[model samples]
Target: MSPIQDIQTEIDAHNDIFKNVDGNRSKMVKSLGSTDEASFLQQRLDDMNQRWGELKAKSANIRAHLEANAERWNRLLALLEELGRWLCLKDEELNKQMPIAGDLASLLQQQVHCAALQKELNEREQLVSSTLDQARLFLADQPIEGPEEPRRNLQPKTELTAEERAQRVAKAIRKQAAEVSEHWERLRANVVSWQEQLERVLDKLRELEGAMDRLELRLSEAQDVQTTWQPVGDLLIDSLQDHIDKTIALKEEIVPLKNEVRAMNELSGQLVPLDMQLSSITTRHLDDLNMRWKLLE
Candidate 1:
């Protein structure tokens, strides 16, 4: 059966015991009215004493159960709090790394843009080579031209042989190609460095995700334990309260009985030991109940 059902069964059993004890106490009080029946009175007193012992044992068991439950609850609470702190720390660490992840994303976008530009540059270089080839074919068809004099027109100009002009143009294109190559190399290196950084950041993020998953599992388990034990805790508290009330009522019941026994003892001079034993048992159980209350607190 369920835990709640088990607790209800225990309560019902205790209630039955309480009814029985109250019934026995009433019988003992009625027996006390016939003081002349010494044998019957002694038997009744012995039965009451036995009942008191049973009650004390039951109370002790209940108290022990309560104490153990309290300790377990306290430990569970501590575990839950510790898990909460760990989760908070993990969250803070993840937040701190978010900026780095964002920066890596930006770098990747720039790298993609740089790659597109590089592709365009390669296409332009191919077009330039094709133009140069066409120009060479056209020049070869014409006769070689000799060096010409400098022209003094709207713009000052230096005339040169075809070969010299071709050499200069080729040299400038080679220099431009070299500069583009160097820029591409530098850009490539930066991209590689950013890629390495991104990998490391991704690794850290994966580790954080794993840690968070484990913490979440632990947190969920703790929550389940808390949920499952809550009803048991409530039942224990109710039982404790009932015990306290019963103990108080029993003490009040015992007071009048003890007084009556004491009066009977003076008359019979034989009931002193039983009265003293009952007092000691009552006192011990009261002390135990008090200690249980302290533990509960």
Candidate 2:
């Protein structure tokens, strides 16, 4: 059964028990005629009335506990509904962003690869530049190597005709020119390729950076929502907790009262016979007073 129903059922049961106990006491009181018997019945009636009072108090307490629990339950249910709505909104927003997030991630991965390739190209370019610098330095130091032969130690040697020397020098110069032109063309091609790769890397890096910024903005927005809700959530929880605390306090108050009633019940049970004797003794004492007064007259 439901909680409320269960509580009501228990209350009904307690009420029935109290009614039966009271009814039985009433019947017993009607049957008694002797003063001592009447006195005992009166004491029983008083104990039964006290028990009724305790039952009434218990019923009130149970009702208060139920009402407070119901209130807290309602608050919890509302909080849960609010949370559900908030989560639904968040989920919808996240769903809307999913495709964009996927695209950005793919682009970022591609950019990473492109950046790596560009880095490699830059390294190659640096190597090529260093090689050219070494070549230039080698050429600059060429004349410094080897010593010139002394003219005094040289034998008279036959000199070639100027036209012949010019022809031979022209042929050698042409060959060197062809080699230098080929080397410079290859270097230019390498430089162009490196520049293209570097540009691609820089472009990809920029795209990745933009994607990162967007991601950070989205995260910030999510954090803002969380921060906003946290306090509201805490307040709701605190309010519910306060309700629970009040319910507990009510129970705490009721327990001592219940214990006092129980103690009174035990005392009543102990004193019943003594009260009956006092009633019987008083009845006989009055009879003796009546007889002595008649004799005295």
Candidate 3:
């Protein structure tokens, strides 16, 4: 029979048992009125009633446990649903707009954004972990299976199905937790890729900035040597040699500057479009440097 029907039948049986016993108790009291045995019989009946009440209370405790289990099932479903929606939304958003930065300022900002995104993912991961633990705890604490139960433990088949139901729910929750964790890993990979790309761009920009700054200083010093060429307190047979050595040293320094510029451009490899201003400035300075070098020659 169905659980509800079985429960109703049990209720009816209990009510009939109590009703007949109560009627018999009333008849006995009436029959033994004002007798010494009447008080002793009343005490015995009171003891029996207390024992029966204890039995009823045990049944009530079982029913209360069942109700609590049902509430836990609902809680697990709700948490899984909430976690699923957040995972899906974040996955879609991350895929749609990858991190891209055109300049160092924006690149630094993108790094911050990525860090914050990862922090959010970490929080979600913890929630998923706790939810999975809760599911496992529910499974551990859920009622035992009917088939494994002894004959004395028998109940309505439908009510005994609670064990199977709990197992299925836990299984489903486990599957969802796995999927959510996978989604989190995917999002984390994208963030890592984004951070790597940012590092590449930032490294290139800083390298170029350093190289260009050095080039500017060396070029200015060389220009001053060429434009303001006055021998410092010297009139000797080897005076011409000093000028030639000075020019040669300046030429050597400028060669590395050119090499630095070339290496940077090659590394950048047209993949990242740097600012036009930096390129234009480098080109202009190199042209002036070439003209200055020729005058020294």
Candidate 4:
């Protein structure tokens, strides 16, 4: 069956269900009669009536949809038939065969399939969009009713006698006092919240300030160390003198009052030991000097 026919069939089935519900309600009501003992039966009847009403509404909506789809499909089919007839007339007049019939048939089938798919997609898109709109509205927490009536408008305002006016004034004063108290309470609450937030922000700022102070102190210490190390640059050439003397002493070993040199006796071997010690000390001093210079720079 066609899509439109299928929709119509479904509508018909829903309508049948609705009608059967009405019969069930009537039968239950008749069997139970009008008595408190029949309350359960009456309740069932009322539920069935409500269900039938809802089903009837659904059926009506489905019927409308089916009719619309049927009309559209019919119009499209009629147009396709007209086009087919036109193509046949054209082929007869041309008196030529260029596989136009097969091409036209294929194109027509594709167009029909596309139209069907598009219609289905549009219906699904509409349903989804509607559902999404409903969900958004539900989540938005919007008010369901109009604004409340003004407090003063709850009862009409009127003039009063002198004594009544005094009573009214007293009542007004009490009401104003209550309103002021409430307002002050709200203000105090807000102030407390703001104070808490301010305290947190102040604590964070203080922490940052403390960190900055520590960094400044370290920077000052580094500067002092740098100042202390500045003379090293002037003493760089003089520092090499100690290395040179050590080298020369290894070369001209005249005094032998220290200990016996029996293990190794080459000047080159003595030079290696002196050079290694000099290199290690020089490396430490140079690294320290470089670090201080970098800090100063």
TM-score of each: 0.30, 0.29, 0.51, 0.25
lDDT of each: 0.44, 0.45, 0.64, 0.42
Q: Could you tell me the lDDT of residue 41 within candidate 1?
A: 66
Q: How do these models rank on lDDT, best leading? A: 3, 2, 1, 4
Tens digits of lDDT, candidate 4, 153-272: 234665432323323333333333344334434433543443343334334333433443443454455465445443534667767676566546543442231111211122213333
**Which candidate should be chosen as best, given lDDT against the real structure?**
3
lDDT of 3: 0.64
Runs in model 4 lying further than 4 Å from the true structure? 1-163, 231-233, 238-297
**Runs off by more than 4 Å, candidate 3:** 1-66, 96-99, 139-175, 216-253, 270-297
Better of 3 and 4 by lDDT: 3
Runs in model 2 lying further than 4 Å from the true structure: 1-11, 14-27, 35-41, 68-72, 99-297
Cα shift from native, residue 201, model 3 (Å): 3.7
176, model 3: CA deviation in Å?
A: 2.5
In angstroms, how far off is 278's CA in candidate 4?
Answer: 53
Residue lDDT tens for model 1, 137-250: 433433334444343342545564233344334344444444444544454455455445555544443443344344334334434534443343456755877656654654
**Leading candidate by TM-score:** 3
Worst 10 residues of 3 by lDDT: 143-152
Q: Judged by TM-score relative to the true structure, which candidate is superior, 1 or 2?
A: 1
Higher TM-score: candidate 3 or 4?
3
